[model samples]
Target chain A: MSASGKIVIALDGMGGDNAPAMVVAGADIARQRYPDATFLLFGDEARLRPMVDKTRWLKTACEIVAAADVVTNDDKPSAALRKRRSSSMGMAIDAVAEGKADCVVSAGNTGALLATATVGLRMLPGVRRPALCSFLPTVRGETAMLDLGANMQCDANNLVEFAVMGSVFAKSVLGIDAPTVGLLNVGAEEGKGNETLRDAAAMLRVEDSPVAFHGFVEGNDIGAGVVDVVVTDGFTGNVALKTIEGTAKLYTGFVRQAFKTSTLAKVGYVLASSAWKKLGQRADPRRYNGGVFLGLNGVCVKSHGGTDALGFANALGVAVDLVKYHFSDKVVEELNRLRQALGEVPAAAAGGVAGAG
Target chain B: MSASGKIVIALDGMGGDNAPAMVVAGADIARQRYPDATFLLFGDEARLRPMVDKTRWLKTACEIVAAADVVTNDDKPSAALRKRRSSSMGMAIDAVAEGKADCVVSAGNTGALLATATVGLRMLPGVRRPALCSFLPTVRGETAMLDLGANMQCDANNLVEFAVMGSVFAKSVLGIDAPTVGLLNVGAEEGKGNETLRDAAAMLRVEDSPVAFHGFVEGNDIGAGVVDVVVTDGFTGNVALKTIEGTAKLYTGFVRQAFKTSTLAKVGYVLASSAWKKLGQRADPRRYNGGVFLGLNGVCVKSHGGTDALGFANALGVAVDLVKYHFSDKVVEELNRLRQALGEVPAAAAGGVAGAG
Candidate 1:
């Protein structure tokens, strides 16, 4: 928690499709919900200053920091890293690195944001790589899934590290005390997936494991909410995440088309509009727009670039929540705890060690 | 196509959750739809004959082929192969290989089914490996995706073979002519996935390609119906398929919960019951039960292990349709065409060649 009783959130005002307008409006919306939060807005001052000035809430709560260059969505991570000193996205992440802000929120290019954050804040000790973690809508409210697209190829150790980080994330952000974690595989069976997954599962099943290791979970288990945190290599995680998003959109489209097929259907749709509205609210992707970069030294939240003001606001809320809960510190502590527990076993016998303890 | 007007479908009477009861009931249902379709039921004749005889439709449409042993769902592919002479699932596939049946349908162990069919029927020339292909519900209609869980690892050539097979399967069963195929990847960009995927995409882009290659598509495109055939390695394909199924179930669960939340919502649901029913029918997992084994010399469809009679019936329909359309022959022709088109260039320069021609 901040000593001043107000959390500082660094905002990349020149990122995303709508850029300044969405950033300004989203900050205002977030400000209303988080009265104890302040913003360090980074972008082209000429464009962002007017937008902030027009917004009554942002005018009072945000301070604009001039950044000449903006990282475009098409910019590769390597290219974005080279422009870190002048890009708005880079400056926003730097605010977190410099401890000027509690967390950074950017509806920017995902690859660029990840690259900037990794180089700016650096990875936490004992963390091999940072994973992109987010809350996905599941049957049991929402479940935290990680490594959405950070490291495409992951070793068993990377997956084990992800399990610890994802567990800490679920607890800190989703407020689950001892979140159950499951390694995403082709089947729930012990030997279902490739060697990497099997090895990761073995590590997670240790007695003193940080997460409540739930053997192995299949893809269907993701939406079933079989576990609080679902861990996977970035390649599989990204595919599953996008597939869920796409499937939801497909179903929604089907419902819309079905309603318009006939007059009776249209009338029925009108009658059930209120109920459907509630369902839509509950399943809205905007409410879960933020993807937190877990295992980083500082809190970094990535909002979807194509999101609207509401989505961006929700992402900002995620950053605020994470900072308030000290997510990064907790993750570091958990990882250290996991390493200590695993280190006790003899190095040569590590592969044969079964339990987390 | 089958020489006779009647398409013979070999039924694995001992497979799936419901087993003999569901198999008999499913055959009766399928018979009602396809009067020309006959079944060769493989299982314990003592148990299956009694069940089949009790049903008027099954009694006339199905013949019992005695097989004492059943392939348990957990049986390894190697173990299943050892029991090829005795297991019901094996016998069912053998019928197809022996040309006693036009096609075979089983709701048995996927790995076992794939292994048995591949060994029994052999892969069509030019196909490096057989792919597990199935219809997935998409916004436009159902799209055929291959390598659902057959080959966990695949090379670029294997992916190209899958693309050809998937395109042929789509045309034969889904009745889509000139079906557009897309290589499944992390991103749609030319530089987006692993080297193998990039290489496959390069091959698919050739000017005279047998299938209509639509370049790369992300996970979301699977449900968006961006292409008629989505091709990928088994690992990614299986994960994506199950993710879609899981997400759909999650949403269905949400709707059920929402409608029960309040009395007014209950009333709204009653009024929209008809529309909701239609939506349910369209999105029913049972309606899309069968997964076709492509690239094999024979037709084999794997149904959901947990599916009921209606679902099993749908699986039977898939096998019948595939046999009627001579799916395997079409796939062989398409692969040959693809190979010939690529063969125009020097053998050493084949991989670097781009465009269908």
Candidate 2:
């Protein structure tokens, strides 16, 4: 937030596939949604100025900050940090850290964005690590999942913290009251899964813990909306999320193929097009575009690099919502409460929490 | 195969949801497909005799073995092993171990089945553990994946063994020529995943490696059919497989809901019913029912406990195919070749390796 209490968003104009244009256009859409919000467009001014000037209200809404370098998709995170600190993605994160902007939204290389954001903004006071979290649509409603590729492997404390972060996230974003949290495991039984899971489950099961622990949930439980929050180590969570996306595409292709099989089927598809459109709208990947970096000092969102203007705008909306809800403050409070409860159980301390798996 | 060159299969009659009836009926169907394959049905003779008698050809094709006990689904693997040795599920596994049957198919408790099978048939030479494998429908064709919940965590050597085991299974079962292998990891890059993945990849990339290692593959690649075999630690493989199943169900539900919206949709759904039927047939869970326990000394397949008669029969087919192709002997050959290649790399030694993740 700025001195005048207006929400200021830093945009990485050169980040995504259709850069500058997509960034500028997405900002234009977001401007209408949050009229009080201001923007800082960081990229090459020569290219960004024209793109901003062409928008109806973007010229008055945002200012183009000059940045000469970029972090390409193929660039390693370590290399990007060393060589491209002056890149659009880096500058946007810098703006958030320096309080020049309220939060940062970048559609750049995920590893680079994660590294840059964590380094620049720093972790929250008690957070050992920040996890990538996002809400995925389920049959009943949206469910928030965390540690989505931020840490490939995690410990008991890490998972317990994610549950706290994700529970707060679900409550704030999904508007669910006392959201249920489940540990993603191979089975739903109490004795099932690795030592990390068992330890995490023990911690969560304690009375007065921050989250409403729902015990263990399997992969099928994810789509069934079995819990409001699904927490796991990054590698498994990332794989599950990508597998869901790929399976959706595969099944959708099958549906399309089935419709094209015969003349009668084609006619039926045309007559039932509205329902298909509704289904598409309900399950649109674009609507769930942002990957929110939780446990950071400030709001940081990573949009899908290949997303279009609409998707980018949706990512911006996620940042706006987090900022509006004072998500970070709530997370700190929840973490404190969780830690206090965990303190009663000495085994949950970070030093004793390395996973046997 | 028996001394007379006839295939022998042992069936656990009281294992699945439909139990003795489904097992007997499925055997009747299998008898038609393989006239020479004799079944040894292990269960209560009172229940099994009637089911076989009711079937047209099952009475002649199968011999009922009286086993009073049965392993319940709720029994733990360790408990089942201790107390249920005389149980039908146990007797079925025993027959294979004693060479009275060439293979066994059980739709009983999964954990119990895996534990009992491993103890009874034992692991093949050079195999540290047995892996659960199953082929899933992909965009191009089917992709074989392992070890689906056999080992919760895996090291470099465990994964290398799975690659060899999965490669041989794909060639023999899916009939894919010289099946390409992929280590299921968080990313496709060489430096992406944890130490376990890196070590496994290094072993696979060697000059004289037995399997065709196509670098690393992500979760999306499983459905994209990027490789014929995907090898991973049991936890991730199980989660990915179940996620694929969940996503397929979620999308299929969406397709069905779209056709239930209005009068026009209802008419369209009925007219396009054939397409839906065809689509259902293409993605039928029954057709992909069996979960093959690879690296075991004998052919052992686990059918879905909830599956019907047709599904159980499909599992029988998998066991029959493996027996006919001398799967166990071929696995030994492949494992020897893989071990020889890995033997040259001193770092690939099991005692020296453990995953940092």
Candidate 3:
């Protein structure tokens, strides 16, 4: 009966490669599946009406909140957010800040979305910077890799914050308590890699670590699932992310080609067609589409530029789940608690434990 | 007409992951395949005697250059080469330097192999750094990617030298005349990535580049076969190489799990078994095993650490082919000619190329 029982997710309609269409399609699916969910689509009134008309159920199920403009992926974040206050990304984040929505979602410029959420929704107490978190399917299980591309230049403090935020996100969202945090480096040995990673590893290994700090893990171990949370600077994280994406595409292409090269192979292909399709779907980036930029005050998701409708739907689904679980507030409260526990901050009233906006 | 019609490559009996056994196996295969080919196995008299005994026909067919000790993978290159002067790696390189063997083959420590070859056989004139080159199989075909993990930190000059040596190796050995060289960066744009890559990209675009410089390429394009040669520093290259290996392993594993999930899947699995196996073999690192450290005075090939007989054999095969074409000399001459043509060096005769060593 209350809004708390039904997640209110504000979708940035003018974001992503297929923008309003994908956003409307995803909303349509979500509304059809979950009656309790309410989506407030933010964008230009004229463009969205045509898109929502196709969805056929937005009149009663979802609302289109008119916004002045949209943020282009190529524009600088600070400049775009400053120039266009009513931009979809900014409006969606504002909705969360104003208590009109529990979470904000954007497939727009990742940097702009992150900046808007950080500035608009306001970070949880004691959380210096928000980090992006996503799952990397490793041999053991899915491990959360953080700061996927949030801060380009991270110091020891930044990494510590990332570890705390990532750990909290993994625990609250993925249902994993005390997730093992690892410092991603060129090697597993303690002192291997660039200065930043080495310093971060040392900071993470402290007895008072906010999370379960594991020793260093190598690039290969990311897929092997050696640790639950892998933390690194955005530069390396971006490269690692793209590298994995490229490799997956390459392997899938090679496998398809290999199967098509022979006459007998064609017969085998028909037999294994369903199985192969499932394998292809499993490897599909759409299933794990949106990469959340955590540490910010609000929930923001960045989808791949090449994402299809399924990917858009997955992004929306993640947003809905995150809002319903009150993911942002949980992360902030966990970090503040850890900070106070570690004597980094004075004991605050109510212990800063609060629900998501 | 003998099977040894081409240049004779000597194998170090005490080198590689499966030394003696793998070394002997590869040599036997090479000898049987190439009627004119001969292998000079070198190692400890006691340990190698049994391995030699097993291949008695290979004994008369291939020569044994006796050495007393072995070089461990973890040993420091300079210290190992200095203290163990009669070690298998040192002696193997000496054979080439002395003209008793055209090239030395070893799957031992890459650092040790590189050091021995650089110190013992000497580097070509004007070559500041040697690159480890490997064939990266792309969708179009196999392209050469160099500096896989030889020089860890490289300057602009070192990258230029790497480009020239890599171009020559790919052209002379792989038969790609005037190979198109691409500088590997985070993005394809000229000004993308960090300072090192941007500077290297500029250096590569100059008129003095010995090969056909095709500007920049991303990690994805490395195996897309868009360029004949992809050049980068050892650190990034190593990461890229391992990422590809890890992804392939992960994808294949996923496929296996998918097939084993159900009886219907099992039926499909059996039907597609041959196609899957063919795909695995084609993507196998063994078939494209061995990385050649170009710019060394003599050819030094570094096989994978996990290599078996087949992979080792591929390394030996590469070494023999390199020697037959006098790969090192061509690189040396090209460097000298480029230096003179670019007015970076005084006019020198063809014989003066040896002085660069």
Model 2 regions lying over 4 Å from their true place:
A2-5, A83-85, A344-357, B3-5, B344-357
Candidate 2 C-alpha lDDT tens digits along A48-152: 998888887667989888998988998889977875568999999999999899899999999999988889999987788899999898878788998889999
Name the TM-score of chain A in model 3: 0.89
Q: On a 0 to 1 TM-score scale, where does candidate 2 land against the true structure?
A: 0.95
TM-score of chain A of each: 0.94, 0.94, 0.89
DockQ of each candidate, alpha-carbon based: 0.60, 0.63, 0.39
Q: Identify the runs in model 1 with alpha carbons over 4 angstroms from their true place.
A: A261-264, A344-357, B344-357
Worst 10 residues of 3 chain B by lDDT: B1-10
| Better structure of 1 and 2 per lDDT | 2
**Residue A333 Cα positional deviation in candidate 3, in Å, after optimal superposition:** 5.5
Best by DockQ: 2
Candidate numbers sorted by lDDT from highest down: 2, 1, 3
lDDT of 3 by residue, A1-357 (tens): 145588777888888888878778877776776677788889988988877877755546678889987789788777766845688878888888888876777778876777777788667666777777787666676778877666656887788788887887677556787899888765676646667677766666655556798877777777777788888766557666666777777777877777777766677667666777777777767777768877666666666656666677777666666666677677776666666655667655425444422
Question: Top model by lDDT, which number?
Answer: 2
What tens-digit string does per-residue lDDT give for candidate 3 at B208-323? 55668898777778656788888887766766676667767788788777677667667766776677887888788898897888887777777776688778878877876777
Residue-wise lDDT of candidate 1 within B1-357, one digit each (tens)? 355688888989999988988989999999999999888999989988778888877789888989978999889999999999888999999998898998888998888998998998888866779888899889889899988988888999999999988887888779998999998888888988789998888888876778899998888999999999999999989899999989988877777777776676677667666778888899988998988888888888899999999999999888887777777767766666676677743433434346536
Task: In angstroms, give how far residue B46 of model 1 lies from its true place.
Answer: 2.3
| TM-score winner | 2
Error of 1 at B17 (Å): 2.0
